[model samples]
Target: MTMAQRIGFGTQIRKSPFFDATLRWGATGFSVYNHMYIPRDFGDPVQNYWNLVTAAILCDVAVERQIEITGPDAAQFVQMLTPRDLSQMAVGQCKYVLITNTEGGILNDPIVLRLGKDHFWFSLADSDILLWAQGLAVHSGLDVTICEPDVSPLQLQGPRSGEVMKALFGDSILDLRYFWLRELDLDGIPLVVSRTGWSSELGYELYLCDGTRGDDLWEKIMAAGAPFGLQPGHTSTIRRIEAGLLSYHADMDADTNPYELGLGRLVDLDTDFIGKAALARIRDQGIRRKQVGLVIDGPPLSGPNTVFWTVKKDGASIGTVTSAVYSPRLDQNIALALIAAEHAVLGDRVDILVDDQPARARIVDRPFYDPKKTRPKAELKAG
Candidate 1:
């Protein structure tokens, strides 16, 4: 039995290539590989990459998630775990689904990518979602074999992603739509192209069959994008911080509900699935804590893991900061926090505890960076 099994917490596992590569890049550079620990002393990407105005960032997120479900009842078995109705999912389509426990806590956010009629892969968080799915399968007596495919995913994100992709893979890429995916042969090698990314920028995830092909794809994209200013980039937590995207375990965990994490849209409580009852209760009864945006009054926050937020209107601790960062895009210190539901209204002024000292902050809407969500889909050029 694994460590998770000994602890009886399902199948929690470590990331394959887990390490921090920030210092190796150079001075004032840092990166978090596969949702590991927050590293020390590194400048935010927005400060460094902003002058380029537009950038093509490459990220290796192979450890993000990879769960394979194969069996006669694979589709039906997986469908029972999510509240989103998957009966209409046609083959060759991918849908974002939330996996919830019986108490309605999110297990791990994963994308249900349909590879074929019988084959489906759940791209997941670092958490042990594979064990959870397997336990459910066995408990329900469903005959299915779940495993992770020997594959690594590369995220090519930035304004110039499409242009660079076209140069490397040809014009056929333009045919794909947001959230859509296709399998194609690039230079005699088969690859999967999914129009998805985490940077909240115009990006595409090319799932190469093996790690050997990754170098070729990387070199090809970089060479094609040299003119477009493409560069190797890992996950920019600070950039994502500005984007208002919540990181798992950092923002929300088993202790928090989706509604409290500003992700209620991801939960379809109307359907019959695990945690549907609990989620309904949370929605109807209302959440005590809410995720809110914080605009720091003082200097920018340097890293993740600091308790610099409070939900006090007039000297009372009502909330706490979950994720904080210095936003280079906004040129201000921004944070996401869980506060009393009443104190979460937009434009409400609150106090943030910076270094044990209270600093003035204001509650704002989510996505402190891009309000329009314009980066996911590229604009079609006029023919």
Candidate 2:
């Protein structure tokens, strides 16, 4: 119910190039992601949520670290990291993938981008995947160079994001298909633009090739977005929960496998990968618990949950709520929970303890909002 203690910064944690800009724009709080200070709140969470849904907003997501893998055997090496079948992945395409340990536990869920014939970047979540990949490479004697490139990404998201992007990058950016990327220059500054984002909305990510240009790029995009009601915003927790986007380390972690997180579609049993055998066995035994959505019948939560709340059935603990938010659009408190596989049914009723008080909840299908998933790829209509 009370605000969290303030975060202190040190050399142990790195700051993004846009840190100053976010602080200047009224960033009220911070959270560490991938060992970097990420702006967690700019002001009111509800307003930030609304702005992202109705207008355009900019987010400094440089914490989405990039693990660069390039070499003659780059593609081969990358394939050995995950269960996803990457044989058909074309250059300039992005795929949502999970890097698993040999035990079939999820290591990281990242958006794998193929930039060239022998180059790839894993736009990672909050995990030390770079070291994991490097260790693997060294042990396997793979012919590849692995490093974290100095590329920081900014996300321009919302319904009006396309317009803001068009104003800054020209109408040609409109042709960028969802989950695809393109390389371009802005005022001679090299950049990689991708039709991708965490929120289930029309959006694009601009990866800065020059870290020094971070302020310059932010200013240009903000100025161009001024006409479209652009605001400095942090990643929207409400929107992500509504869209059923999983947050790394919260919904799942290294101990959690793909099937438990409803990511079985991302695993390819036909492919040879590090966790293929373990996952195949998991498939045969069946998952014990699985992730599902929840509609809580209670008052709005006071703030973002700092700890996992217990989910119960018949006054007995049955699962845990990892992430929860009050969605104004849906007018109910929603949450993501990992519950017993048999209790993960759509209509199962359960109870959750929020702020130490009991509250009733029901199991629901994921993506409490935009279940049809038509927003992220929708074209911006003429204003």
**Residue lDDT tens for model 2, 111-207:** 9999999999999999999999999999787799999998999999999999998898777888899999999999977899999999999999999
Model 1 misplaced stretches (Cα beyond 4 Å)? 1-44, 47-53, 303-311
TM-score of candidate 1 relative to the true fold: 0.85
Clash count for candidate 2 is 0
Lowest summed lDDT window (length 10), candidate 2: 1-10
The candidate scoring highest on TM-score is 2
**Model 2: residues >4 Å from true position, as ranges?**
1-7, 380-383
What is the C-alpha lDDT profile of model 1 across 1-383, one tens digit per residue?
76533642222433322122323433242233344332223344554345223777666576656788988888887787786778778777888777888888877777788888888888776577877887787788777888877666677887878887888767777777877788877786567888887777788887777545655665666678888877666666676777787677777777777888777777766566788888898889988988888887877666554554554678888888888878666788888888889877889788767767778988888788668887676574422
TM-score versus the correct structure, for each prediction: 0.85, 0.97
RMSD of 1: 5.6
